[model samples]
Target: MDQIIELFRHLINPAWIIDNGGLYLLIAIIFAETGLFVGFFLPGDSLLFLAGFYGNELSASFHDAPFVVLMLLIAVAGVLGNMVGFWFGRKSGPMLYNRKDTFFFKKKHLHQAHDFYEKYGGGAIFFARFLPIIRTFAPIVAGIVGMDRKKFMFFNLIGSFAWVFSMMLAGYFLGKKFPGLKDHLELIVIGLVVVTTFPVLFKLLFGKAKGPIKTEAAKATEESESK
Candidate 1:
């Protein structure tokens, strides 16, 4: 048990991550986190930042335009990861919808999710990439709601590019300019977590004070029922 715990600890440690698997492990984690439901606990934003911080070493084998290569590889992994999530969600969505509502489940919520995705799916996919936990599930939810494949792909590509490049490049440039910056990686990681997490918590806690806004689909359903 102790050995397993310690191994898990090292996996989350950014410095340890860079030292051990370097680029490939980083890529794999990104893929897993974005696609696999089980990867929500893995360190993502901080890992990308640190990968950029250690770009010189990680990118060494590439020789020419190493930073660009590193960013593209990571971005592609992210895109593929989201695609996997979407596939899983799509495969399982019908089962979820067909299942009888229990004490913990309600069909209305599913309809609401469908409506919400129809309206804001694109923006959610784009922005969720920056928010931990949320990013992992957003694509899956998009799949559940039957979001248009072409639309999902368009945003997936753009969002993955934006998220990977922004986080990694920020670290790369900062590390280049300040040689001693990595000394404060712990503080930076904490800040990234807080920044990404707080908004999600706030939205969940307070965004519903006014109650659920009636969506057009809900209204249409109501009208049909009345008829």
Candidate 2:
């Protein structure tokens, strides 16, 4: 936990990256987080927030690049990562379903992705990008289900840009308004997680209540027609 937090601090610290190192690291992290299934555990949202928070510091220290440029680069990295993930999922689509005993590819993950895809449809591609566990599995599920390539790309791009921009901008603005915010960054991060996860919780608890009646009514109509 300590190491992770420190790493997060370092990545966002403008002083840590004088030149190419910062850019490369940021891009690599973005790609891994979105493209690799195992990378779901990474601190994507928090990292973006921190990046925004430190944007000013970086801008002052680095003359060759502005903070906006860095943010744009990060945003582009996130978008490309999703595209790569989608393609990877598509490429491994068949093996993901058929393989049973692989270390990296678990059946349960695939099933969960399937359920999310079923429950939310294409919207899941966008919405899932906010949630932790779900976000990681969404692209893989999209690929496995043979979701339309153009449609997935459209939603994926929109979701990635939205998420990256919001978090980064929030960090930057908040840091500017309240310099002390850096002290309580963890709390802010928690708040973000809560806000993002609430929708998924709402859907799970109430989605059924909204549909069972209509389902039963349809079933009754079909039975009456048969009789």
Candidate 3:
């Protein structure tokens, strides 16, 4: 935990990156976090926030490297990451569906994502990007479902930009105003995750109740047609 927190702090410090290796590390982390399924556990939101927070720090310290540039780089990384993830999904679609057990595949997770996609369509792609664990699986499931490529791309771009921009901006403003936020950032992040996930939870519960109702209605329609 301490190591992770330190890493976050380092990323936000600016000098840690610019003086050390530069934007390459930032770009690689962003790409891996979004594009690779194994990267679902990576700190996407926090990393963006830290990037922004560090931007503030760097601007004050070095008086160079504007925040807008940092935002642009992160945004581009996120967009490209989603594109890579989409292509990965498309390539692995058959293997994902046909084989239940693969080297790193979990059928239950795949089914859950598929169900969410079915209920929400492309909107799920955008919405899921905000919801931690689900975000990683959403795109892959969309590929498996063979969602329209153009439609998926539109939603993917929107979600990528929105997620990266909102978190980074929040980090910049919040970190500047309340230095204490830097202390308890993890808890705040968890709270954000919970809040974002509420709608999905509600939909899952309500959907169960409505399922039988829809089934009965369908049966009634069939009987009426027979008559």
Candidate 4:
């Protein structure tokens, strides 16, 4: 477990991101993670936070990197990613269910995301942005259900702004203040991931059936009218 966590520690390191592909790569990953099914394994929250945490270093190295502007662009990337994912779901949702679950992928995640959309409708698109894997699947589920594109885009725009800016900005500022947190990043990342995922988990395990409910009073009224 320790080894695994340690490995992940490096995976989301801001310096690694900068040294690797910098702004473009970051945006691409953010898009791919949310838009592409194959991107399910990428650590999004940690990466965004890391960008904020290491904003100074990143700017210094990149020389002319616009910190806030980059974040906004990242937000755009996230929104666009979901939009693409929505289209993918519309086109390929059938094949998706056919593929079996693996260590890297789980049909359960899609089902859970589907439930979120069913229960909350357009709102789930906004909500799912905060959750990791669910964020990836949320837009897709919206597509599968054939949600209006306008509604999806509206919710997607709002959710993307909320998710990307809020998270990345928080990371950037928090990182500036608590610079030491990065040393214990595995713990921080785990805690963040757990806290965010808890709501999804709670809803899935304990949530009541939200499928169409016929009220007893309505049923009685209909029967009386029929009689």
Candidate 5:
């Protein structure tokens, strides 16, 4: 357990990440977190933010690679990751989710993603990029549900660019201006996680899930009665 937490922490630390793998690590992590089902354990929001905040620190090492190129690579990784995830979901379908739950594997997230996709459709794909767990699963479900390829690509492209660019840019600019923020990097990551996680937390605590499920179930009952 301690080892797992430490691994996750090391992965989330922007300095450690860039120092070790430089740009490639960032691209790999961004792709895994956004595109792969097993990637839910990875932290995407904080990673992007830290990458942006520590952009100079990262690029300062690469000598040849410009800062903008690094950011673009991260964004592209995020985009491609979703494309990979979409195809995985489309091919695997819901049956892929039947495995038993564990610390790293939870079916609840799949249900939540399903509900979210059902309620919001394409919009979920765009906005999920901002949210945490939801972002990881949204594209997978979108594929499973047979969303039109054209529509999925359009939104996924838009969401990927927006999510990566915005978070990375925010970190870049703020880190440059504040200078002190680097010291609080861990806290900033935590804060970002909390903010990104609030949407799903709200649904779980405030009966949001029950409302949707009950409404749908009731409608089904009514249809049966009418028949």
Candidate 6:
């Protein structure tokens, strides 16, 4: 039991992940986080950033190239991950809508993903890659809505490349310029989490839903105006 607990603790630690699993584990986590519904809790933004921060070390197996191989592999993993999620949603179809929530599933997230898809059309898949929880579900929702396979792949490829390179390169270049930046991994991770998550939380908590619901005050005002 203690060993299992300890392992999970280490799993969330980006430094430990790089030190232990290096390139392979990083790719697996990226795939799971984007592809698996239960994997929504896994670190995404921070992991990518840290992978970039340790690009040379992670990519040490590949000489002659610095961060190129690292970035490309991660990008492929991300793309493939979304494809899997899309396939799952496509297979599951509307049945997913009727399914009850469980420990690993939440109806609200599915609903939010649906709303996001409705509002953004096909771009939600691309945009959701930056948002944590939604990133996991956006591709699934794309499949559920029966988004064209070619169109989904279009956004999936571009979004995967964009997300991977942006996050990784940011860390890669910054770490290259400032060696001491690694000393503050906690701070960097926190900042990245806030930057990526705040928008999603904001949208969930405050973004307009499918239709406006009238407040008591709104109802009173409408009644008075009608009178």
Maximum-TM-score candidate: 5
What lDDT tens digits, residue by residue, belong to model 3 across residues 1-227? 67766775675454576675555677777777666676665656656766666566644443566877767777788777777777877777656556655433555555566677777989988887777546777877776556788998899888888988898888788888888877776677667556766665665455443221122334577899999
TM for candidate 3 is 0.70
Tens-digit per-residue lDDT, 148-190, candidate 1: 8999999999999999999999888989999796788778877
- Residue-level lDDT of model 6, residues 123-226, one tens digit each, is 98899898899999998877776789999999999999999999999988899999997778778888888888887788778865453222234557899999
- Summed backbone clashes in each candidate are 0, 0, 0, 1, 2, 0
The per-residue C-alpha lDDT of model 6 at residue 21 equals: 69
| 173: Cα error in model 6, Å | 0.7
Please provide, for model 4 over 45-120, each residue's C-alpha lDDT reduced to its tens digit, 9 standing for 90 to 100: 8788777777777666666778888888889999999999999878877677778877666777777787778679
TM-score of each: 0.77, 0.73, 0.70, 0.80, 0.86, 0.83
Error of 3 at 176 (Å): 2.0
Top model number, lDDT: 6
Model 1 spans > 4 angstroms off: 1-12, 61-65, 94-119, 204-227
lDDT of 2 at 151: 92
Q: What order do candidates take by lDDT, descending?
A: 6, 5, 4, 1, 2, 3
Question: What ordering of candidates by TM-score runs from best to worst?
Answer: 5, 6, 4, 1, 2, 3
Q: Which residues of candidate 6, in runs, are more than 4 Å off?
A: 1-14, 61-65, 206-227
Score candidate 4 by TM-score against the native.
0.80
What are the lDDT figures for the candidates, one per model? 0.75, 0.70, 0.68, 0.79, 0.80, 0.82
RMSD of 2: 7.2
